[model samples]
Target: MASEKTDKSRLRRDLLRTRAALPEGDVPVNGHALARHALQLPELTGAHTVAAYVSVGREPSTREVLEGLRERGVRVLLPVLLPDDDLDWAAYEGRDHLVPAGRGLLEPDGPRLGPEAVLAADAVLLPGLAVDRRGLRLGRGGGSYDRVLERLTRAGSRAALVVLLYDGEVLAQVPAEPHDRAVHAVVTPSGTTRFPAL
Candidate 1:
């Protein structure tokens, strides 16, 4: 287990370094395109509720996509990271509902919802440092999303777990720890890429 953690740490560090070296503008542009594409996926179409993350740093900015979802009559839920690193969800009525949570991340200001509410979401848009063809995800080391995904999976629902990234950030392979959650698909500026059959 220790060796596995070490391997994941090294791989995560390397991937972060590689992502940091990418051209800045390319990241946001790709992220925006990917978010737009995700909205078109069958998993998202007609889904009344969706869970999305607020992009920070190189993570894709889903603000426009969320607003677009609202315009299409889909209710959006944004995750708020708590002190214990667990996710508390809130409804995203519009851009004005966002308030800085911490570390420059923004979240909706409203009633907090439980994990069940998140599980009810038809699609969950995840943020990650890197994702591989097998759907292994390398997160920012917080492990919050990993835990949340595990909870969602254990609930017996096949909520689509989609990771947004720049085209280059999708790696050939990513070291996975026992606690790491595999994403269902990866989206980039070019198009949506489904993962290997799980």
Candidate 2:
């Protein structure tokens, strides 16, 4: 168990370093490609409300994906970080509605809807450093998304859970704890990969 934790720590450090080295192109090209790939997902195509987050740093930018979803009339819900690191949600009106928030994050400036607001979403997009072929995700050492997934499970949510990653971020394996949940699919700039077979 300890060895797995150490391995996860090592992998996270290595992956984050690689991400930091990426060029700041506003990630326009990759962002738009990620958005385009997302459109091909049956889960996304069927979803009306999608719980998502804004990308900061070199993390696969959700900029184009968010804008595209909004343009297509999808009800976009963005997260607001709480003091405890759990997320509260709000409606995404547009880029102008996002304002600087703590942790160098941009959050929705709209009314605060409780955390359960994600329950109404037909899909949920998650952030990750990497994902294993089995769909286990390596997050940024924060348990926020873990809590969100727990809440979704307790609520029996049918919302499709997804992760947007860069091509190389998909790996053969990643550390996983018993409490960890597997994501349903991963959308990369190249294309989409599903887990547990649809």
Candidate 3:
């Protein structure tokens, strides 16, 4: 267990370093491609509501994807970090409605809908550093989304779990703990990879 945690932390550091080295122009280009590709996913196309997040810093941009989803009439929910590191959600009005928040994040400046609001989503877009061939996701080690997944399971949510990443973020394998859950699909700038339902 300890070795798994150490391996995960090491992999995260390496991934983040690589992300930091991306050319300045590639971020938006990848974002545009990601938006185009992600919009076509059956999960988002068929979804009435999507729980997603706004990318920050060197993370793969989600701005274009969020706007595209809203234009298609899908209700978007963005996360707001709570004091305890759990997420509370709010409607994604537009880029104009986002305000600077803690940890260099931009959060929706609207009314908080509480964390349970994610249960209403037909698809949940997770933010991750990497996802493996087995579909296990390696998150930022904050445990926020872990809580979200646990809540979803406890409520028996059928919401499709998805992750957005750059092309290289998809790997053959990543360290996983027992509590980790496999995602349904991963949409990268290049294309989408779907996993059989868990």
Best by TM-score: 3
TM-score of 1: 0.90
Worst 10-residue lDDT window for candidate 2 reads 22-31
Give candidate 2 misplaced runs (Cα > 4 Å).
Answer: none
Q: What is the C-alpha lDDT of each candidate?
A: 0.80, 0.90, 0.96
TM-score for each candidate, following the candidate numbering: 0.90, 0.96, 0.99
The TM-score-based order of candidates, best leading, equals 3, 2, 1
Q: Which candidate model has the greater TM-score, 1 or 3?
A: 3
Question: What value of lDDT does candidate 3 attain over all alpha carbons?
Answer: 0.96
Among all windows of 10 consecutive residues in model 3, the one with the lowest summed lDDT is 189-198
The alpha-carbon lDDT assigned to residue 93 of candidate 1 equals 79
Instruction: Give the distance in Å from residue 197's predicted Cα in candidate 2 to where it truly belongs.
Output: 7.6
TM-score of 2: 0.96
Better candidate by TM-score, 2 or 3: 3
- Which scores better on TM-score, 1 or 2? 2
